[model samples]
Target: MNTTRTLIAAAIATVGTAAHAVDLKAGEWDIAIGGIVNAYYTHTSCSGSQAVGGAALATKGLGCGGTDGRTVIGNGLLPNALTTTAKTRQEGLDISATLMIGAAVASGDAISNNNNNVDVRQGFVTFGNADMGTVKLGRDYGLFGSSAILGDMTLLGAGAPVAATQRNRVTLGHIGSGYTYLGTYGQIAYSLPTSGGFSATVALMSPVDAGTAIGRNEPQLQALATARFGGGKAWLGVKRQKFEGTGGAASFTMNAAEVGASFSAGALGFAANVQSGKGLGVLTDGDSGNRKQTNVLLQATWQATAKTKFGLNWGESRLKDGAATDLRSNTNVTAGLYYGLTRSVTLVAELSRTTSKPVTGEQARMNGFALGGIVFF
Candidate 1:
């Protein structure tokens, strides 16, 4: 697969259950395991008779028998996922290992690649404590862009289009819709001792080899630092990689940087961030591997009642090009509601609209609404 395909696969699997590992004491290993299953009823409509990529179709939604609209039982932002963790103490130090897997939900042939075949999302081990700091080694999410995802309100439902046809009905939380996803990788990460609400993270990651690009022999550095105080927190992250092309193609380099801030008081919360870089991979996950891009995100939420919350968010992802005729930007707007049905079940509803505009000034639009619930075990 190419970089775009690799990135799409990664982003498509973003809807994860993230069950709190259930602890089952088994000898020296405290085996904790759990999983979650989520699905949604989606109704999407298009302004024109074409699907995302100009594919000719009926007037109704994919399954609705018309090209202008489609309706199907879809997977929301959270997919069926399972997580297991084992922890113990050694030499007066704490140690632990975790394994997380997830897949899409559907009957489509492609769903097998995205859903039925479980993919390992997290496989890592950590060692150490407060005084000794901490060390982590394995495959997991890159430190960059994680904070932005953590604050996104789309965790409970679908926010962005994962597929052009939209039959799968599942997608990553606001990725490419409200922000960009940071590709996961294998790395050795270390956390410095915290001081006065300040902490730092540093990792040496295996060079990215998504698609046909070659992995650099040297490790890439990923760094992040944050400060938390009172009702707000701020963070910054940076990463750099040099890619060797396959098939004797030209080699290239990528550099990425992102900064974000979050605040909360009483029943109100807010977050904002901006990221920019060249060859850092957005939309294509470095497929082109040389496109310059920038993203800006803004969001806010209100806990209106003990069991109800309301939120609205907006974001824009822009690609800088040498020629004005090339692709320029994709913008999104979203509003949603979350209501607790019970401690273990939550009801979710969301509406979103996205527009893609090229330098030629033409625009293509897509709008979607998702209704779903998250059931925790």
Candidate 2:
């Protein structure tokens, strides 16, 4: 069995699952490497008239430009990634550093030389031991909504594909519809050593603009508390930040909270989460105004056989402005079948439906099907 040494593996562990990372020892330092690579072919069909003009709620609209269906071959919600880590104990303190690089498999068009999309998602260092809380410095995923996304079944496959023209893009996977993306952030954070099956984390993260206001004056604060028990776990997280008025713009604050839980019994798994916030946009953190937003996610999975699993999920995000009648929502549902072809490879097939509903306009709806495979190592 492999130890949980890689950051990616640690992420998966949050949801009561783990991945095997190949490890090596070089003298005094221990090294490990692991990641995932996946690709999918997706077809999206649209129905109902699209809303006129640009509506913030229009969001992805299934990336459909018209009623005609579109086909795309590209990466899913998760891009191909390669994570490397090195750790050592010095002077009674354990230290480690990790760097994760990810790229889209679709590359680009058939041009002679098309550029690919590559990014460094995680670059951080940690120093501490179980006796003392660990401190993380640099860039990594935020705590808020981290569990929600990690526990999502679509994390292993495609949920919603947008724009067939941009093959290099990754699928949505309920990002804008279900939950705000817990984007990686530059920050200083501390994780308390686990005690009594409970642990917590707090971070002061790099700031960003909140709608029209600027947040350069202060840092974003994020915290999370998690509890683990037999065959189950639960978590709660919060995020808060203040933005200053710039160029006569009004000042505003962004605050968000989320709660989630996951558990398994007799090869059957269930998960659910809820998020509500102000000034938290449907997709990203910042949007104009201190609008109220809420998100809900529900999922269930069953291990039908040693080599096969089935999953179904529903999620929605709603944004409401000050106006009583101005409300917009995005919703998506996905049904997936996963088969383990090998110890380190899995095949996936998924069908998904997405809808965008505005207070006054035609609803934009899309249906999609995806087939893909993912390998972990």
Candidate 3:
């Protein structure tokens, strides 16, 4: 009986040791993979030129037979011809994915990755903790590139005019259309620990060169601070970029700054943002000339029920004189509503209208509407 009891105790100890060894050396990593699939039907109403039979066709020329006068071909294929009409139609899907990995780091050292082939969604490695803040490096969001009130909800496609513009501002570090800006360069950010519901972050990013002439441009710097008081939150931010070359033979610099606030009460939220800056051509209009601009956006959101929310937004941008007027000034208004279909799925419908007046005596207006569903995993 004594030998049997001793054998059992020894076996238990051996098993415990093996479990500890596995826990220490195996599966010590954490991985998270997520994706969003947004399928939408879009309709637009705008008067624009269309193509017919591989040739530019006037708006009135649409629906006409090709210049070759050939209409029917085998399998509905254009026999040496094609045709297009300026008809509003519906379109398909927009999908994106993201993967994140994190691991324990030793003091003074951090985890890093090549980030190759990864979509421009997000990629970064942070070391340290709240006490000492943290050092983050890799492709990531730029400081001051987004307003706090808007940044928090960018994933849902709502934000300030500047924030929305930043998504397509190529020379300003935005990756491009249909992709999130990863900033493909180095970034250093420090996030102060939350204190009394207030926090701040300051970050700097290396300049992204668009060409040889712009290769030597100075680095981009941004500073953002946010404070929450009562039921309202206010934020202030600044961003600067120095173009490398002389503009119109005049050597100068470009800068931009923004301030915004948001307040909430019960089921309603109100937010407003304003930005004024110089040399924003890096993102708007894309001219190397010096220019000053201001943009403002106001939004309101209401939660009518636990599963539904509605939003309205209005935005406008104006370019100061001495700037090219081809792009002119524009105003946009968007209204949207979303309903939660499930824990991981949502249905959204939105309508947007834009009006522009160009300095070249051209006036245009566009209206677009989209209905979509987003599935997350």
Candidate 4:
């Protein structure tokens, strides 16, 4: 084509791409960038003198100090993060990719060399259709408890108080305390088309590698189905896996299940979930064993005003017959408020109490209060 024809074709291509995405445009691709910056000042009082050995504990010489009270700067439940996305419309389908990373905000490390600095939170590609289904591959959140945490009121603030010295720039919203951790993992997942407010998902994931004479021979299988009714949504998920090695030891098997729901009536919202498993790793690391793990979570929120909200949440996680030769459990309760200072800025405050206990060890209790702000762009 001639120079004039080429220029006109380029202009037309730009206009055609504008209907798909926003932020910035480059060649045939649309670029979008966004992020959240959050920081909190926290005061925690610990009640325990026992020092078993874990990096996360409340002893006179460990984490935050027991009975002496410690104050520090940390992150809320939502860490300071940056996300960049690119997408294109092809054959009536949305083909997209996303990259999410966390920043070290409160580490006081000017070089961002801290342990929690700049870790990849998500890197995934997806293809979806409004009438058809969706397929995703790469690293992303798991399906079992995604809704429970997404609907949690504490997602905007600190919920469970972890070890201060070992804090990772962000608080846990009942992750290790109330539910089996739903970590990000590599998987090929497919979501059935949504129909009448219902949908289902099936995934094949890399299996856990329990150390034995040999490695397991199969990938883990997971499935989840959700239904929406009235003002709430409910979900059920199940997972099954087996780790076998030849030699003298027996094969290890894991069976896990979870159920959860979220509902809203007027300005009041509630959410709850429960999970149990035999031989499922507490953090879903794919380590096969004969241990038992269980967890429960509950939350309630109220929108007091257009820009002001109040919320309370609780959760518990337990491990019985664990490979460690003892039982362990954690329970946490949190109450907080969120006030929107502007359309893209928010003020958050929270108070939380958590207890950690082991079968034959001293129990530890921690009380913490946090004040923070989050800016989104």
Candidate 5:
């Protein structure tokens, strides 16, 4: 349920000389087909006597629920996607359409007869030229927090898994710890043509309830600006939304801002991102009480060899407003090794430790390991 401007390319790296897409020409239209398929065997172990359920982890019941550890075979952060694009030029206009379907490998664990779910993550169309920018309609990636998720190295593999029993959903890859998932949404958006490695985008997206009881009468506003220089890229993004309380809750407004940058030197790459806002849920979006929260993610990667890579990252999300018993912070650290087994396939292994701390209580901890392979074409 998440995507960035570079979601496709970033999720499925163009490895070696293997073609990431297949192009065909039919009359006046050009068509391309591409996709990624991945699966992982994940094991998680948890400790600490304190129940870290809803009190300390905002995405409670996810990852680990206590001393019980679970194992699963499932999709990673980025699900299996089959995407197709068709483009053509007509009447001095650049027109294109995209449709992507995502699938999962795991089925309901406890269900006697159940199948995995498929997500129509992206179904959008665009029309415009370089001189006039582009207008996008339908569902696509949101503007806010786009850079943060793209900057995360775990996008290629699983970083954390939800409850051991939950198999149908994709694993959590630093989602609640590093940054809130900027889920895909139906929207009408515009992108200013790129110039000098700089570009901008703005969108009005569908409203989300975000586990809160509120009335959303208007669309959410999201915008982003990005700049690239040399081996570095930086971005700034903001989002705003209005909420009217339903029942007895109080009315509130949600506002958030984020800044992120990534730099590469030699075989080493680094990334950092920070987001802070009011009414932004610690793990997701809106909050009924309009709490303040901040999240930070830092990453480093090394290209060990022509076909081998190593990476390490740490991230945390903290809530500034909470009672003594309320959740406080969720943090995670992960190390990974990725090897290119073939032109279009990669072998991945990752280890991660997650910790959740409350305002006043013993913290909870979980350690996880994931082994997987992903292929692209």
Candidate 6:
């Protein structure tokens, strides 16, 4: 049998076997495992200097570049010091395992891999009940860290949002191959009982030391609230991060807020979001100038058929000199189509274009296209 068919059959058999085993259990203990495989090919074109080292650096003009500005696409697959290519070929597997012990102790881990290489995505334990809400300890999703409208669902390829755009400011920044370290973070989330087609969720998060950064005596806190009404949903979230006692040489704080909404009717869905933040540093002169940043996004999806879907996304980000005026900006547009080959497999193709304003005497533009497939089991 083909790989897709084999995986689907194995999943079905495993679930069936697990269900039978659970029926013989005396107490509440449950376990489940699942995974997804994604692969894609990408091509890209670029102009001017790309953003580098949190600052836009000079590029030797426009050309087709791989993942790390390597002249050869194969060389870009690995890490490099210069510009990181916005698009490249990649394949990976995301696996998740969950365990529940009675009604109080619950734990899970989500891991991803490029080929056989492992990357930890989530590892956390939870304690609580329906009436008391839940408290999660360890590394997990941060409060206000992700959007409810389209959680982690990116279309195939070159059109995918950059790592920064998809990141949750309430958590540590993403690094290396688009992975975010959960760090030492804890979360408390509560959902109110539904009434009249309305439901709400409020969450809070605190930082933990995951050893990613040492001697970093800083704390971060976040709050997020979301409400759903009929076919529409809205959310507001805020985060405050402080880095203290680095001998006043390099310490900074970031404050961010975001608002978003989404609506769905029939087979069509629409969503929009806006986020703003300021990064400030303390110096001998008392709080040197701050950097202001804003991001906005709009997206739409249509389930054209039982086996086909279409999507469009547009986003823009601007950075300024603390007055909320745009000093430099980046904008991107993407459109794509997906076709389901089976209940567990899909094929996708997409195109994307991005443009950036003048930064350090240069302008940058990039365009790319991609095609790929994904299988879930």
Best by lDDT: 5
Query: lDDT per prediction?
Result: 0.67, 0.77, 0.43, 0.67, 0.78, 0.42
TM-score of each: 0.85, 0.90, 0.65, 0.82, 0.93, 0.64
The alpha-carbon lDDT assigned to residue 376 of candidate 5 equals 85
Residue 92 of model 4 has an lDDT of 91
lDDT of 5: 0.78
Query: How big is the positional error of residue 24 in model 6, measured in Å on the Cα after superposition?
Result: 10
Q: Give the winner by TM-score: 3 or 5.
A: 5
* RMSD (Å) per prediction: 5.9, 3.2, 18.3, 8.7, 2.7, 12.3
Q: What is the lDDT of residue 192 in candidate 1?
A: 81
Q: Which ten residues in a row have the lowest lDDT in candidate 1?
A: 1-10
| Candidate 2 vs 6: which has more TM-score | 2
Score residue 220 of candidate 5 by CA lDDT.
Answer: 89
**Per-residue lDDT tens digits of candidate 5, residues 54-110?**
424323355554336777788888778888989999999999999999877777556
Per residue, candidate 6 scores C-alpha lDDT tens digits across 264-292 of 79988788777666641110001222456
lDDT of 2 at 26: 94
lDDT of 3 by residue, 120-209 (tens): 423555554446654555555455535422222223432211211111120111111111122234666666766776777777777654
lDDT of 2 by residue, 203-321 (tens): 99999775468788789999999898999999999999987877788877899999999999998999999999887766667663577889999999999987888999999988775
- Which portions of model 3 miss their true places by more than 4 Å? 1-26, 48-118, 148-185, 210-217, 246-251, 282-288, 322-325
In candidate 3, where is summed lDDT lowest over 10 consecutive residues?
Answer: 73-82
**Each candidate: how many clashes?**
13, 0, 1, 2, 0, 2
